[model samples]
Structures are given as C-alpha cells and as structure tokens.
Target: MSMTNRLKVDRRDGKLVMAHFYVAFISLAIGGLAGLLQVLVRSGMFVLPAGIGYYQLLTLHGVVLALVLTTYFIMGFQIAAVSRTSGTLTSKQRKIGWTGFVIMTIGTILAAVMILLNEATVLYTFYAPLQAHSIFYIGLTLVIVGSWLGSAVILLKYRQWRKENHKQTSPLITFMAVVNSIMWIVATIGVAATVLLQLLPWSLGLVETINVGVSRTLFWYFGHPLVYFWLLPAYMAWYVIIPKIIGAKIFSDSLARFSFILFLLFSIPVGFHHQLMEPGIDASWKFIQVVLTFLVIIPSLMTAFSLFATFESYGRSKGAKGLFGWFKKLPWKDARFVVPFIGMVAFIPGGAGGIINASNQMNQVVHNTIWVTGHFHLTVATAVLLTFFGISYWLIPHLTGRTLTKAMNNLAITQGILWAVGMTFMSGAMHAAGLLGAPRRSSFSEYGGASIAAEWIPYQVAQAVGGSILFLSIILMLYIIINLAFFAPKGEQDFPIGEIAETAEKTPKILENWKIWIGITVLLILFAYTIPFIDMFHHAPPGSKGYKLW
Candidate 1:
C-alpha cells in the first residue's frame, strides 16, 4: 500500500499543507469578526465607531472568507490529497509547491493590507464601476496568478504519475484534484482577461472609462464557475472521504468520475444565467445558458444519489433494514462523519434554492435582494464552510502527528451544530425579508420610515442574533484548531480515503480522456458566450469612471 493509503502523509509534505491551513484559519478569524460587525450594523442596534465604514467591513468579510479562505484551503487540501494518493512530491515538485505558496501568501497579504487601510472597498464580487484602489486590483490579480502557479504543481505531479504508471488508473483523489485544477485554469481566463486588459488599465488611470456590461459579463462568466470551484472540493470530501469515515466503500468509482466530468463540462458555460436581468445581452443567449445551467443539476443530483447509495449499502452490510433504517446506522458520534453530514443535509435546500435563482422569472424575484444573500449563505456558508470545518477536524490533526481526542471531537460536533443553528436564524430571516422586498448590500434604513421597510427590521435583528452565534462558533473553531495543531496527544488519526465496493463496475477508460472532456468544455463555453462577448461592445452604453462611495 502507498504511504497515504497507509494513513500518513510524509512529514516534509505535512509542513506544506499546514502552512495553508494557517492562512485559512486566520482568514476565518478576521472574516468572521467582520461578519459579526456587519450584521450588528444592519440590525440598527449598533453603530460604527470613528471612521469604520459598512461597505469596508462588507468588502473585508467577502474577500477574506469567500476568496482568500476558500482558495487557500482548496489549494492546500488538493496538494496534500495529490501527494498522498499519487506519492510524495519530488524535491523539484516540492520546491514548486513552496514557490506557489509564497506567491499566494504575498498576494493575500497585499490585498488584505489594502482592505485594512480602507483603500479598497470593492466586495468579493469585484463588480466594476464600484472601483477600488489600483493596488487592490493588482493584489487580486496576483492572487489569481499565484493560484495558477499552485495548479501547475498538481498538473506536473499528475503528468509524472501518468508517465510512471502506463495503462493504469490515476488515484481517485489525485484525479479529482486534476479535474478541479483544469476547470479552474480554464474558467479563470475570463476574469484574468478582464483584469489584465480592462480593470487594471482603468484603475491605474491609463483609461478614463470602464465598460460595465462587458466587465460584468466577464466576471459572471468566471463567477458562476467560481461557485463550483468552492463546491467541487466539498463534493470531493462527500464522495471520497465521508464514506471511509463511516467504514463504507465508494458505491461506484465510475459514477464518481462521471459526475466530476459532468461538472467540468457543464459548469462554465452557464454563467449567463447570472446575467438574465442585465441588458445588452440577447435573450436567446440567456435562454441557452439557462438551459445549460439546469444541466448542472444532473451531476449534483448524481452526487446526492451516490452518497445515499454509499450510506444504504453500508447500512445493509451492518444489518440495517427498512427504507429509512439505513440512516440510523451512520456513525453519529464521529465528528468526522457528523460534521460533514450537516453540510450534506444543508446542500439539499441550498441546491434547490440555486435552481430557483437560475430560472429567469425567479431570478427577477430574488436578484440583488437579501434572498440572494441568504441563498448563498446556506449554500456556501453552511453547506460549504461547515464541511471545511469538518475536514479540518481530521486533517489538521492528521498532518500535525496527532489524534482527535473524544473531548475535542465533542467540541467539533458542537461547532457544526452552532453553525447550522446560526445560519438558520440568519439565512432564514434574510430569505423572508427578501421575499418581502428587502434589498441587499445596503445599511440599516427605515426608508424615510416607510411601512414596508418597518417589516424588515425584525428579520434584521434575527440575523444579528444568528451572526452572534456564528461568531461564537468561530471562536470555538479556532480554539479547537489550536489544540489540534499543538496540544493533542501524539498519535495517528487515519487519513480516510474510501475504497471502491466489490460489486462496482469497472470505470470506463473514456472518462479519463482529457482531450475529449476539455474539448467539450471549451466548445460549450464558446457556444454559450462567444456572441454575447462580442455583442457587449457593440450594444454597451458609454462606460463610467471609477466611483468610491465609501
């Protein structure tokens, strides 16, 4: 068995992975604090002291948690998974890994420092016309560029593995990492183009005006896939790690690979669904992209089905009977299983909400409302973020040469429960207020004491209540992580990677054909966006100069 399959990452490699978790955990602390402040301000029950601006906090929270935390964690997690499943990186590959880590850390610090100075108030979306400082844009560009460098390490390692083991399947976790890396490289081209060509020039004052429609077009093009970038890693945990934690096998390796392929093919071409309400784009193109957007539901549902199967199969093997009895057979006491399980259950509703947002008519109802905010909170915050926490519970200890003691496991479970409870209060209120016409991205207001505005106040307070609980959870999370990293008893905690079940069919060779998959992914992107991309220039109104309202 490989060293990784034997439940330990090489010590040299562990340091690299630990570096990433450090940044990710720090981001959680900074971002989580900003989030609490935002909620408090929105509730109209508190006021900012001195010169602190609401949008500044909003920008900090969005960029740090959404972009910084997710990217660092994913990159680190993928690197470690690839190293474990494939083999420890060679000295050259390890050097490349450290290089990427350095560049990414530099970029993160630059961007974060700018935000702290209040020079950049643009939120995570980086939407145009709401301009931030040139350094901020440059910093973010470096962040993207640094990630590309990190992705290169994964590709190089995978290529090396392929050369060494001809006619053999790649390790499952390593293969999934490659798929995600390829998708990210392809998807970020849109954002990179806009940043290097348009936004950078404009923000630097070399250009007087910026094209809003075209910029937004490029952003959402990258934006929607950006969602999957965050999601696919969580899916990785669900498909590979969760089953192992429960002592079950993967229901089907082929199903898992196919689902990931479907994600790569269908995820990028559907960004137009986000632009349905915007003008200057043809309705026909929007309709096409919307249809493509719905196609994404297939792989998502496949994942759901596969997880259910894994659970059911394991339960049956353990003597579970009746239709729903299998659910009772899961390891409820295991923090590794239970923490991610909450995230899985949260995705059911989180995903349904996504389908609604994609529908054109439905998009109009929720677009830019607190409903949209609420929707993502459930999806990314509860569904995605909580799972990251769960992964950390095991991963941090695993890398640090320690084990999860029962007391710490209990605390980890409490952290997840707190997150769920907090999100319910916060996101549920935001959804309700949104349906009643509360706009998002605005500070507390009675709108000249308007009757309609009065109705949203209660919901705002509820969000504050939830936000407070979430902050408490964050504190607990950090404490638990510190313990795991430094104070845990010296022992081995298994790095769980699920094995394929005996009855599973052989994975078809076609699934690994990168030429065919990338060819299709590229073609679909062109089909969905080529015309709109060109037409945006022709149909766009005059561009606007940068604004700094904050």
Candidate 2:
C-alpha cells in the first residue's frame, strides 16, 4: 500500500499529527528528567533538594511518560498512519482531531499542575484509598474523554473510506488504526467508569469513602489492555511498515489482520492477571483470567513468526543463503529499521518476563517487586519507545517537509543503541534485585541498617548508572527529533506501507466485520468479569476514607 505519488503524509494532515507530537516530545523531556532523578535518589547517591519528594518524582515520571507521552504519540501516529494510507482526512475530521488534541492537552496540563503541586502523588494508577484532589480526577476524566474523541477520528476516517470504497478491504494501516481505536474505546470504559462514578465524586466529597477492591478491579480492567494499546502501534510499524522499509512485501495480510483481531479479543478479559494476588476476587475467576492471559501469547507468537518470515523472504530475494544467512541481509544501517529492530529484540526478554508475571505462582514471587519495574522498562520503555523513535526518524521528517540526512540517521541509531545498553544495566539490575526481595514503589533506605537491605545497594548503584546512560540517550533522541522536525533538508520522505505478498491468500472479509469482532470482545470481557465483579461488590466492606499519602 505504499503510495507512489510523492509518498508523504499530506501536509495538512501532517500538521494535525505534529500538534500531538509536540506535546509528546515535551513530555519526554520532563518525564525523562523525573526518571533520572528517581533512580539517583533510589541509589542513595543523590537526594532531592529541600521540599522535593522521591515519590512525587516517581508519580510524575509514571504519569507523564506512561499516560501523557504514550497517549499523545499513539494518537499522532495513528492519525498519520490513516492519513498516509487512506486519503487525507476531510477538513471537518481534522477540525475534530484538533479539538481532541486541545482538550487532551488541557487535561494533561491540569493533571501536571496537580502533580507538581503535590496534591496528586497517588502514583500513576491512582489506586483507591490513596486519593488525589478533585481537580486531578477531573483532569484524568478529560484525558480519557479527549482520547475517545481522538479515537473517534480514526473510526470516522475508516468509516468514510469504507463508504467511498464500497466493500473493498480498507488500507491495511487504516484498518490497523481503526482496530487500535476501537480497542482503546472499549478498554478505557473501565477506567472512565472508575474516574467518573467513583474517584471523581469521592474526591469532590460527594462520597465519604471508596471501595478499594472495586476501584482496583476497574483499574486492572483497563490496565492490562492499556499495555496492548501502547504495543499495537509498534506492531503496526512492524507488520506493515518494516517490510516496506526492507524493500519486501508483507508475509500475509490475512495473518496480520487475524493477529490483530486476536489481540483485540485476548487483550481484554485478562486484566485479572494483574490483580492475581489482590483479595476480594475469587480464586476461580483469577484462574480463568490467567488462562485468558495466556491466550494472548498466541497472537504474540503469530506476530513473531510473521516478522521472521518477512525477514527471511526479504533476505532470500537479496540472494542470501543458509538458515541464518537471512539475518545478515537486514538493513543494519538505516536508523528507521535499526532502531525498531532493537526494540524487537528487547521484546524477547520482555515478553518472557510478562509470561512470568501472568503466572499465579511466579507473580507472587515478583509482585510489588522492582522486577516488575524492570519488566515494563524492557517492554514499554525500551521496546515501545525505541519503535516510536524509529517511526519519528521518517515520520517527523516526512511531516515537516524535511529529509532525515545521513548524520541525523546515525544519531538516531546511536540513540537506540544507548537506550538498549542502558536498559540492559538498569532493567537487568532491577530483576536481579527484585529476586533478592527488593520492594518496588519505595525510596532508598538501609532498613535501619538491616543486613538484608545491604543486598539491594549494589543493584541500586547499577540502576543509577543505567539511568544516567539512558538520560544521555534521551538527549540524543531529542536532538535527532529536533533536527528532523525543524532543520533537516527539504525532501519527500516516503511513508512505507508494505504490499501484500503476491502468493498470500486474500484477506477474508470477515476480518473487517466490526460487529462480530467487537461483539465477541465484549462477550469475553463480560464472561471474564461478571462473576468477579459481583463478588467484589456483594462482599464489599465499608469503604475506607481517602489518605493524602504524599
């Protein structure tokens, strides 16, 4: 589906996505600094100056990077993907896009101010019984709602394309954007419900106490799928864009769509795996959700196989021989490929760690441990972040009428390598220390000189070292992004979208049947949750009053 006509995101559509990217990049800087500070403080090598709290920085780091940055970038990327594949959005669609961006930006600001003021240091999850200010909850509500508006833009574009094309398979990228949007809309309902019906009123003093179990259950309902929300965009690039970048066709359009639909089904109904140890949820339900969680591994493995096949086919075309010779035929020099390729490798270990987290017995060992921190650092921070960065290598320049010159591409590749090395040290240390029983979500201490606490100190120092390297990599990334966005030479940068392989079977029309897929997704969610939710509410204790922990 690579456009041959001066391939680029249309300038007007470019502006819309760029608006979101500006905020996302700004968030990278703020959140990156906060992360660095956190690691340093945790290492006992530095203390926050007077009045600056460790947990406060931790909260800002989590919320800004995880929520603000990811949300903004995913929206921008999805919009760009759709516009590049389907024709440019109608002017009204762009207007709606901008409105959503403005609303989300305002909400981000509101939430940031509350966090900075230390009124909402309840951590990123904003877990109940540890309440934040009413304004904070309101800001959160706005963010979720605004994201819905953003999701609407994708649906509208896909709908318009279907209306115009009449039963044709939608552009693959556009179809992907729609899948992500629909998945997001369905998943966010849980968080939206918690914020509006529970947290908002409770914070406003309309309610005297909160149901911790129900609130947590709702959050995890949204939480695990939230991981998928962050992931699927990178998968979009991997399945669609990477083949084009490597000068080959996609392995199978049908397989790609099937994997996506599988993700949609399996990503939900599995949130309970995150709450495996939490009380008030029946053991049977947790076991059910855990089974559901393992089902996600199917689609994940499908994606892995697809990439392997794509790579091998590309290699054979280039005259490579032998089983592993295909690996040597890859584009090691292109920043757009190299950077995201690193992310793919990171996901190997990251995915393995996730499997452990999903298992009830294994989750107990690592639950609330810094190992969980290490896990997400690999998955989200390294894998997802690097892939997004890779997308920017071309996407930013493409949007800005600029070319990613050789120098900038080199810098981008360097940035990715630095991130990998840093993550290895930081995340590896975290996992090791967690196995030694170091707790997560806490500041550095020697536990009143207890001998066991001493075991964690070396790992803490290692984390600080890793964090410092990551900050340097962040600087490189920002520099590359700035150059691409503003100062690179003017040229057309092709937005790559792989064509379906000639031998591949036609994509089944049923894959695009939104009603059947979404209906099944809803059913799976209900099947997984109804019994557990009923149990949570029926046996609920008198809710506890909010605490301002910070």
Query: TM-score of every model?
Result: 0.97, 0.97
* Local accuracy by lDDT, each model: 0.88, 0.90
lDDT of 2 by residue, 518-547 (tens): 999999998999988787677765444322
- The number of the candidate with the highest lDDT is 2
Q: In candidate 2, which residue pairs get closer than 3 Å at backbone N, Cα or C atoms, i.e. clash?
A: none
Which parts of model 1 have CA positions greater than 4 angstroms off? 1-6, 446-448, 540-550
- The deviation in Å at residue 461 for candidate 1 is 0.8
Question: How high is the lDDT of residue 188 in model 2?
Answer: 92
